[model samples]
Target: MTKPKLSTPAPVIEKVAIANRGEVAVRIVRACQELGLTSLLLHSEADRSSLAYRLADETLCIGPAEVGASYLNIEATIQGALSGGADALHPGFGFLSENADFAEACAQAGLVFVGPSPESLRLFGDKISAKDLVEKAGGPVIPGYQGQDQSLRTLLEKVEEIGYPVMVKAAAGGGGRGLKVIHRMDQAVEAIEAAQREGLSAFGSAQVFLEKYLAEAKHIEVQIFADHLGRVQHLFERECSIQRRHQKIIEEALSPSLSPTLREEITQVAVKIAEQAGYRGAGTIEFLLAPDNQFYFLEMNTRLQVEHPVTEMVLGVDLVKAQLLTAMGRSLNWQEAFHPRGHSIECRIYAEDPYRGGMPSTGVLGFCHWPQGPGRRFEVGFEKGDEITSYYDSMLAKVIVWDENRPRAIEKMKATLRDCVIFGLRTNIPFLLAMMEHPEFLSGQMTTGFVDKYFSRPLKEPSLTRSDRQLAEAVVKTLNREGLGGPRPRGPDGEAGPVPSPWGHSWRSGL
Candidate 1:
């Protein structure tokens, strides 16, 4: 299939209803403010105390705490947006961002969806269809089976044919929800079933596809933007190889693995694919770069990515604002020759226990502090006194840092992560810090298996010294005196009794 003709009329947008939550919602709200547009946050009941709820110009409770009844409920979101008098709706990644039905409903309701056309969504939403389109565009695709036969016998046969260490992915999944690597024949059934279950639960699709798993492949993606007139521009690439269970944790701009020639080749191919699909708004064409420098199309993310901040930081551009402008029928007018300035790195700060293998840490936040400094940017979603619930993603904030070079950027990110103080939750900051110091990571030669190969086991718990204990006691005393979340009397150890912190009895403050 060739690029579809562009004909959707751009309407004037005054109010943008954000059909999402967390830091991305906060991101959209701020962008709307800068563009002189009103932002309406469509949130669930559990998110009432969120920072995004507080930042948006208008707010509406779409449904209950469950995502199925709220964030993923098409009718509820549409009704909420319409009732809130929004001229447009922005699904800031995940949930309904790439849902074609949601985009069509927005158009029917006269609300401009700040994304590509519904046709484009449907085309790229399915992994099988997307791969076909990419192949039609003469792009390199990994050896995989995207055939319609989803039966167990067929999948098994295909897996045997493709050999072991194959990747099983959901046909309609993103963000690594239904992606599994089958290394052995005995693990095939369980992995495939798990992938299907996750796919059905997360994306309402159980169909899966198979791929040749490149063990040492580096995850590289090109950020592409298309105007209303079918003009597509490449904002360069992002290296997201440092991932856990296919979910990216640390992302950087201008991958350290790519040569100038390879970078140009990959980016141009990405542009070609986008133009072939007649893609509009913001989208990312992901690829897997092998050790031999050969790259293959992995997938396409048809929405603003979580790591967009690193791209924006290096390029000195605002993608959220660009999405809004595209929705308003305005041209990006990007420079033909754009030079990426400096290096930027982003670490996703999740509310989880890193020492305990990243177990989710949920509770009322006691206190939070992000050290202010130049070249450091934080996209936070919660504040002190806000509750971190189990109903949503564990991510609390994104810490991004920019510097003159990659080495400086890495050091700056390390310092920034260390300076962050989240008193309530046991975050993955320790894990991120360790990864930052890893020799493979420092050398920029790590691949998709970086986490599994080196950092798979739980971290060694650090012993608290007498001075650390003293500092903890002093901090707890201050919190008690200030009546922060009420006073916690005393425990057996008499160390201020947990203080609503996720660390339980231990009170190792800050990152």
Candidate 2:
């Protein structure tokens, strides 16, 4: 890796502490390695055997498996970094990534936080403040109420004024927590209460806001990066309309829905908002593109997003590396303009049963294979023999592929999904494939409500024939007797599975 030219004398950042888990942790570890920095993993007890734990230069057990005691514990993270002799801390994506208090704690502890400043986090952490910033920056905003009135009567009155089909969202929430769409007056109170409860539980704040819900809107976002000199650059936009429960599953760079004129306008608006907020490092400005092509500001994410790989693939830049350089007060040497080369698509592979309404599948992984080829990039967190527990997000990996066009990219992704393999647990591959084949998806006309509109139920499976069941039973018996080519069969489902072996158990067998 070529060292980026420095814009100013930098405080030496020799070591970095990763304060998250799963694939994002693996990503940070690799970035640290490429930058020739020592990587210390501050992990919970449950993640001791994770792949990131083995890849990092050092490891420290911060607390137990529970998030509040481990990943979300700000003081514990700071102390772990200090004890590990880390010069900086990288809170990847979730947990404390967007917590202003955590960032301030890192600064107070004399550790550089590899993200935007604490002030920036605070500005965007609350949805109300973020919306105000957008409005002050002249960015278009949806018609809604952001007042301080907390009474039910005031809220209900405000809801009536905003009309039916309003969106109730947590002021300090993301990733679909504390967000609800109230379709009618009868459902408004219940949805509001639910959003408040979720907000309090997930983000520690029950303050809620309302927005006019655009039922057919497309979810789009622009990526922005700012340097120490306050130079902000927009990295185009991504389409994240195909979502479930307001959380994105598939994201692609260079949205198919935007025209050149609209794209220019939206990206410029994003830059203006970031500049107005004094944002630094990596951030995202999300928006909703209505059917009439009018765009409105949604909210801002004050950290590196999970879907950043698609942007990296299209623009041919490493955002994580740029982030590190920015933290060190270095210039990115970015060009005056960036043109996306090709279409890139990323599918979030989750450990869930697609036929069971995306039920979480937890167990020891076995015989995992991610096919390698041109334009194929995989960020995986677990390997064979690692357990996939329910303590955290169920996403197992992110599969990204690039091609000259969207259609070709979609085809390549389908072929790639078909060639890939995983054992001992069900995955959402089938569901993703189904989504890829949908006409609306193929046409790139999917909206934010696509999943809820078309796939409200579990995928239906083909009825099994008697002969098929008999064959499956025979295979299971053979495997049971052979003991997976060992002296004794491995114990229960997740406790002891095949190790250092090529065998796999099929979930379709129903044994």
Winner by TM-score = 1
lDDT string for model 2 (1-511, tens) is: 2232222347689999999998999999999999999999999999986899989999999999988899989999999999999988899998999999888878777888999988999999988989998888899999998989977789899999999789999889998889999888899889999999988977788999999998899999999999867799999999999898888899999899999999999999999999998889999999999999999999999999999999999999999988888887888898889989989999999999989998999999998999999999999999999898888889999999999999999999999999889998999999999999999999999999899999989999766766765666566556656555322333333255444344555333333
Q: All predictions: root-mean-square deviation over Cα?
A: 4.5, 5.7
**Compared with the true structure, what per-residue lDDT tens digits does model 1 show for residues 87-172?**
89999999999999888888887788999999999999998999999999999999989999999999999999999889999899
Superposed Cα deviation of residue 284, candidate 1 (Å) = 0.4
Residue 474 alpha-carbon offset, candidate 1, angstroms? 4.8
For candidate 2, list the clashing residue pairs, or say none.
Answer: none
**Model 1, C-alpha of 481: deviation from truth (Å):** 11
TM-score of each: 0.93, 0.91
Model 2 error, position 444 (Å)? 0.9
Stretches of candidate 1 above 4 Å error?
A: 1-8, 473-511
- Top candidate on lDDT is 1
CA deviation > 4 Å runs, candidate 2? 1-9, 465-511
The lowest-lDDT stretch of 10 consecutive residues in candidate 2 is 485-494
TM-score of 1: 0.93
